[model samples]
Target: MSRATPPSLPFPPHIHAWPDRSTLLADRELALTELHRHSLGVHRVLLLWLLALAAIIGWSLLVLPVQQFEERDPTGFLLGPVFALLGLASLSPSVIAVVLAVRRDHQIRQLLDAWLALDSAPVSDVRLRSPGLSLFWLLSSLAVAATGLWTSFGTAAGAQAGRSTYADVALDMGIGTILWLTGLIGVVKAVRHYRWALRTLGPVSTAGRR
Candidate 1:
């Protein structure tokens, strides 16, 4: 199908400069770089929630078992549920991150659509990704997924041992499931974005540089 050419229109209020095609692409490449950085930050934040999970689990391990074994102290019993509550509540951020990540992925697709729609778009010299960034995504995602897999089994074991309540198992297993899905999706997205970046943002040819 023949591509529809845009109508000649005056620059909107947001515009001040009329850049050539190459220049516009370069600017867009920079925008994509920033988006990539934002994505990394979001992923990091998502991972940080696990620390809260770990702390809650740690609190439970330290306080609950001792109370049960030693004296059935009501304080420990009370505090245990508090940590569980916090653990469950802390999932809010992970959920937010997931929402943001999903939205950002949509934004990325939209951005790519617009970027490609530009008149005679070509590769840009502006670098969008640093070396090892993709590797970081792959490794970190795999690690998180593995952690999720491990924790899910651990939660099940604890439940079998009667160490955890239904709520505890549910929350713990919920966290694991979220982590597992997020990590796997992250890895896939990293691979995808990396490929797109390479195809559309490679260093410009010498002839094209002129």
Candidate 2:
């Protein structure tokens, strides 16, 4: 009599197996590399946009007729410069934070090397979190955009009263639109990066817990 054949396994044996240490280390390195590249790219883009905005503001201040702006809405004209200055100043912290992130990543690389060479257990205590650079950019951009919107509204009101021209309102609106779009893009990028980091690194450990 022929014996019945044994049933086949549902999947390959390897499918349910955990990754080896080398594989895990390789994955962690790749993730860190990708994160570094993405963060650097974001930093460069933000810096470029900020510099462009600053240059545009400076050019406008030099070329535009200050007297005409003042006549349109004295309060808005004064507030515009103040808001721009504040926005410019806010970027400083983000720049410093980006630099720090780069340095931290470098340190992490060294730590990874040591762990691999020593064949030690991976450090589960270390965790990565979202950097606040994006939020700062968002807030600063919003402040500048708000200034532009206020200026635009003031100019439009003045025009209705025959005290300002449509051109003034149009200019303010354009600046406001640019600022808002730039800020929105930064915010989206920041949130995306944050989510990506979380996904790549896995869930963070709770405070006071191993």
Candidate 3:
């Protein structure tokens, strides 16, 4: 009689019960890539606004020598420092965004290690745990607008100084308008993206069962 086929071996305890570590790592990697992509777009937009601001500042410097600084609006003079401060404030959101990107990247990489399989975190928890970059942008943009208003005050002051003519005032005001518009657009886009990311990720309530 033919011998009975050998019985099938049982799977190892840990291997059979636990989820695959490699699969979890792969998922985390994909998520990290998407986060980086979105963050890069936001950074690029900010860079454009920054470049435009630099251009305006350069133009202002060039004209200062040729045209008399007219101080027309008394309030405009006071706005000079205010606008400068607001511009400084805008840095906060950008810095936070960078930090958030770094944190996510590091965490994802660590999760890949075989020892600690990446656990599924609730979307709400992830969003809450991560830094809020959008809020920073919103606050900073408000500061930018406030600062621009202050710059207008400075322009008026220049008119009052009677150093520059009507044309100079118009030019300064026009430049201010452009900067404000660009900043506003950037702020709006940033907010929209942040909201979209939050929604797309959705909320995770319970921990991964496996």
List candidate 3 segments past 4 Å from native: 1-34, 37-49, 61-131, 153-164, 203-210
Worst 10 residues of 2 by lDDT: 1-10
Which candidate would rank higher by TM-score, 1 or 2? 1
In order, the Cα lDDT scores of the candidates are 0.56, 0.48, 0.48
Estimate TM-scores for all models.
0.56, 0.44, 0.44
| Candidate that would win on lDDT | 1
Candidate 1 segments whose C-alpha is farther than 4 A from its true place: 1-26, 40-73, 76-89, 119-131, 154-175, 194-210
41-95: candidate 2 lDDT, tens digit per residue: 4554566476547644643443244434556766656676765566446544444
Say which candidate scores most in TM-score: 1
- Backbone clash pairs for candidate 1 read none
Worst 10 residues of 1 by lDDT: 1-10
Put the candidates in lDDT order, highest first: 1, 3, 2
Per-residue C-alpha lDDT of model 1 across residues 1-210, encoded as one tens digit per residue: 111221222233132443554565565555544455555555454554564455445434434444443555667666766655664455555566566656766675555445444433333423444447667777777887888888888888768645555556665776676667757876886787677656655543432552
